[model samples]
Target: MRSVASRFAPYQELAEHLLQATISEPMDAAHDVGHLLRVWGNAERLMAEEGGDRSVLTAATLLHDCVHVPKDSPLRLSASSMAAEKAGRVLDSLNWTAGDVEKVRHAIEAHSFSAGIVPTTLEAKILQDADRLDAIGHIGIARCFHVSGQMNRPICDLFDPGADRRALDDRAFAMDHFQTKLLTLTGSFQTATGRRLARVRHDKVRDFLNGLLEEVLPDAMTVSH
Candidate 1:
């Protein structure tokens, strides 16, 4: 708990208390403690510029994935709301005020794209932006492949890698996800800071996809051509 608290300054005590009280077991490589740290780091960066409730954002980030659903699960859409509900119960057990708990709960639920929630609160917006930041950059690239491997999905369709003839299906090929979701995340960011950061990561994804195509394509482009 101290180590976890150390990463979240100014809210070290709150982080420690929540860390001790929360009963979250590790879910997957993509949503592990490292993922939490990355999202919290992003929230801190966003808050530095956007201005939000530090306590609310901190609590939301810590307990956001307390309930985990697999990326391939049919229940993926409900994962965020489920997490939010469970987080509310956890906060209630810890004697948190109902208003603050609701704020945290809303942030957790609205952070998910699958949840289709429009973030109404500043904290919810911040959490959504912060969480999305982790889904696009080099870290996002690593996590994408990691989850792909876990799901037993191929990196891409070698013969028709760009999905020119068919609709994008991320569930079938990992690379299709770039077109279906990852590349589109920049526009969906709720905060200006998140959008700014997302552009840089977004470029990295494009570069990576280009490189991947160069390697896998049958008639790879040549320098002279």
Candidate 2:
């Protein structure tokens, strides 16, 4: 199996151009270039297992968050749409074919959880799976806290670490995100490879949450008196 970078070597120039643009754009730590690359890498792995239009998947992954909105902004739900519009312009500048550009745009538009757009094409599904994959595992944990810190959200609610008693408010507590989104992603993947990988990553998150509950919940941590 070819490495992600090597498999996508043909589009490295375009990828680099996109990377340069992403670096110059103002984005939160959770949605930066590193996050983009991770998503692209995930796309590459998924694409290998599930064949799709590599050009569309690669371009979509690179430009997915180009027009990022703040997590708490009213425009948050529309961020993917905004990115799709910006990506179309960028792809036009790169002289990509109309059909190909449209495919890329649709993939970007449908990749976001908030957008709630069902992906029709295989490339779009791959892009969606790839982006969501990056929101789990250790990196996902880091990103959750990073975004939490940016939004002034706490790491966990001391009394309700799992958000069992109250409505899950990820914007107020990072751990609540697991119950709200991350834990639910494994069942939402669009590809077999994505589902396979998601299950592993999901287990990691579950373990972390269980450990956290043990440490934070008084009953869970009780010792014989």
- Using TM-score as the measure, the top candidate is 1
Writing each residue's lDDT as its tens digit, candidate 1 over 8-27 gives 88888888877654445556
lDDT of 2 at 116: 92
Which parts of model 2 are misplaced by more than 4 Å?
A: 1-7, 220-225
Give the number of colliding residue pairs in candidate 2.
0
Report the error of model 1 at residue 166, Å. 1.8
Q: Give the RMSD in angstroms, all C-alphas superposed, for model 1.
A: 3.0
lDDT score, candidate 2, position 48: 85
- RMSD in Å for all candidates: 3.0, 4.3
Model 2 residue pairs with clashes:
none
lDDT agreement with native, every candidate = 0.86, 0.83
Candidate 2 accuracy as lDDT? 0.83
